[model samples]
Target: MAGILVYAEVRNGAVRKASLEAVSEAARLTKELGGSVSAVLVGAAPANAGEVLGKAGASEVIALAGPKFTQYSGDGYAAAIHKVAAQMQPTAIFVASTPQGKDLAPQVAVLTHAGVASDCVGFTVAGGKLLAKRPVYAGKATLTVKAAESLLVATLRPNVFAQTDAGAPVAVTTREAGEVSLRAVVKEVLAAVANKLDVTEAPVVVSGGRGMKGPEHWGLLEALATAFGNAAVGASRAVVDAGWRPHDEQVGQTGKTVSPTLYIACGISGAIQHLAGMSSSRVIVAINKDPEAPIFKVADYGIVGDVFEVLPVLTEEVRRLRAAS
Candidate 1:
């Protein structure tokens, strides 16, 4: 029987939000296209990984467990997913638009000779065909692409699709990981100092640019992020290139793209490349001394003041509100 297969990506022992979003999107597709929603869990998934995917609308969970699967191995993961796709004969395969997923999707497509749509923000089924909408030209335009081959593979962008409740647990199936010719393997992973939240996954992000004057002034932005409790710190390419922040903290076309619920830009001029990364944020607040700063054009609220002056007051106010609540 034809079904929809979702690659449920796990990070730091838990399933990634983008993967759940992909599964949720698959669940919706199943309702429209008349098929079952099955998920493949790779890596050292959490004990409740199956339950979590089930709640996200996966009717069947295929757990590929092994020591080699603990860390992300592109060739290994692609091989395992291709094997499952061959056995299940899924009509469409969904993967999240993450670093690992981006690598894995193309490999799976090459193996299956399936048509691929990358970084898709939305999906729809019509006349038994899968179509996807994705950003083009630095998100200035959206292109709707159709799958021409029998098998469809697409990577769903994070935070673009909304997740829905599936209401109950579904069946979980365990499968032994098949052996593949190993050319390369990840021996170890070095983690960075832990932040309260990953910038891509954070609901709220506080980002600063060159307006803060220098790296020494980063404490202001950090304080603001601390006030939000669940917020993550981000930086523009300028700050990152200037050695004021790590590249991981950078948000721009060359850095990580983010679509947080609330994005606060401090001392940023909002270059087009920078805007390309975070313009999709739900609510944007730009603080810059210059009213004509490009950031203000896209900001839902603009504050014309020095970031050093504005940040202290804003951070205190946020702390006060949180305490009151």
Candidate 2:
């Protein structure tokens, strides 16, 4: 039986950062439990992706190859993963809680009759059973759950776990994707891979709130994000609700909950609804003029000044810092 199976997420012919974190997180748990970490890559693992997974701590990478499985099909992915799970009979299975990962994990869980946990923030082993820790009630509470199945399945929250690369060597094995067939097929798969930083993978994020005024002023936010080099741009629920940004960029209870190392909230008031999303960030910097703003309560650092004025200065400072480095 395999020890732990991590679903390696690939996007647009490359390895997704969430998949790297998933394997790294799994490796930690597996080490704690005296087990192994095995990764599964569907839809023809891209070149070097298997190696990347290994570096993230996969003891073995099963790379499923073929064009038929190129696009993410729920049924096809479930069948493919089911095939591996049956053979591996792992103690735990980890999948990223992405749009695609969410769809596939549940289907595989049903097929394997494995208990499933979604958006687990933490995990551990006790009495040979896996325990998952997750937030609930819009991050108002935390819950610990134990799956009854021998093969435990969970969807890992992206960016929730800090990635620690152990540098495991690559060991890639291939399986034909044709072995798994879907009842439905996606006719086209297209992506715009340029000019966007994936927030789930970013170590630092600069998010804007209603203080930005309008979408036209979004250029300031973009410049700030660019100043940080790898930082992603996020939006408050108010901004999203106002159609100032896409739902995917929303960071709140009703949106994407992020746990980056650094979270910069510009013009955000830190409402409970919004705090539900980013309160877990390691270091929060609030750039709001209001000293009484609730966000300052949770912020590790606060700049009591107008964001409109502060942001431009901050952007220049970050630019200078990066240039210096």
Candidate 3:
């Protein structure tokens, strides 16, 4: 019967999907604890942020306005978060487990001396204490934990909680946007690659393991992704470390945890470290020449054959499906 604070992340004039999911999770937590959810943002006042958060199930929206927020400054964002938290005094706080959210939460936690939980899969309040489920040992094991006190901070993995419209009217208010000044400035941000799909936004991902042979043969994976149209190309830790692909494309226990609708594994051996990251996919397809590969155990569909041979057929089939559609 208290208030839980949810952080809203906005970029390119819209709220990020992960931020909405945080609101959704916050809404659920608040409902269980009999508390209201208040959404917080630190940016040039979002045009309709209040209504947007309300639609996403936020009972209240606290906008910390400052032009410096247009671009992410960790210190500024953290300082602003601390300011808002000190004012709201919510029983609990929730933040998305994004790159920025991970970077920003510690400042507030230190200020309030609240226990911080990162990369939590889910949460619940038990015996007046907050309990959380988090991945440990690079995702090999999931541990359930409880915060020492009610003042709590948490981060939720992306793609775990799908975003949906709250469908409720939200009231708007204006506040003084705080200033955060820094000596160093961002020069520029270059895209990973031209026309390359964003790893976080892809619905289907086709990843290559060490069996792909070498970097020169990456064309096979790219062609498959191209055939899928909306699919992104990903790589296993071995493939990335071997210089076959950028590190950003790596998906493993230490890398991004994705829940794509479909995932195609080419030449992957399915190390426990690798499976820990992608086991949550809705559907998994494996292509490996070795029948004994560990990946087949978790795959919904398994094709035992050379990826070099199977990939062309799969790519063609996907292309034909897209063409017919």
- After superposition, the stretches of candidate 3 with alpha carbons farther than 4 Å from their true spots are 45-52, 169-171, 179-187, 323-325
Which structure is stronger by lDDT: 1 or 3? 1
For model 2 the TM-score comes to 0.92
lDDT of candidate 3 over 63-181, digit per residue (tens): 77776655777767767777777877887788887777887777668767788888788787787567889888866688898777668888877777766576475775556755666
State the displacement of the C-alpha of residue 285, model 1, in Å, after optimal TM-score superposition: 1.3
Q: What C-alpha lDDT, on a 0 to 100 scale, does residue 172 get in candidate 3? A: 57
lDDT of 2 by residue, 76-175 (tens): 8888888888888888889998878888899989988999999899897888678999888877788999986777789998877766777766868998
Give the per-residue lDDT of model 1 (tens digit) for 1-325. Answer: 4779999988877888899888889988888887888899875557787788888888888887666776678888888888889989998899998988888899989998999999888888888777899887877888999877888899987887887776367656778876865566778766687534778889899999999899999999989999999899999999999999999889988998888989999999999899888988899999999988989989999999989889999999999999999
All candidates' TM-scores? Answer: 0.95, 0.92, 0.89
Global lDDT for candidate 2?
0.85
Against the true structure, whose lDDT is highest?
A: 1
Clash pairs, candidate 1, are: none
RMSD of each: 1.7, 2.0, 2.4
Q: lDDT: which is higher, 1 or 2?
A: 1
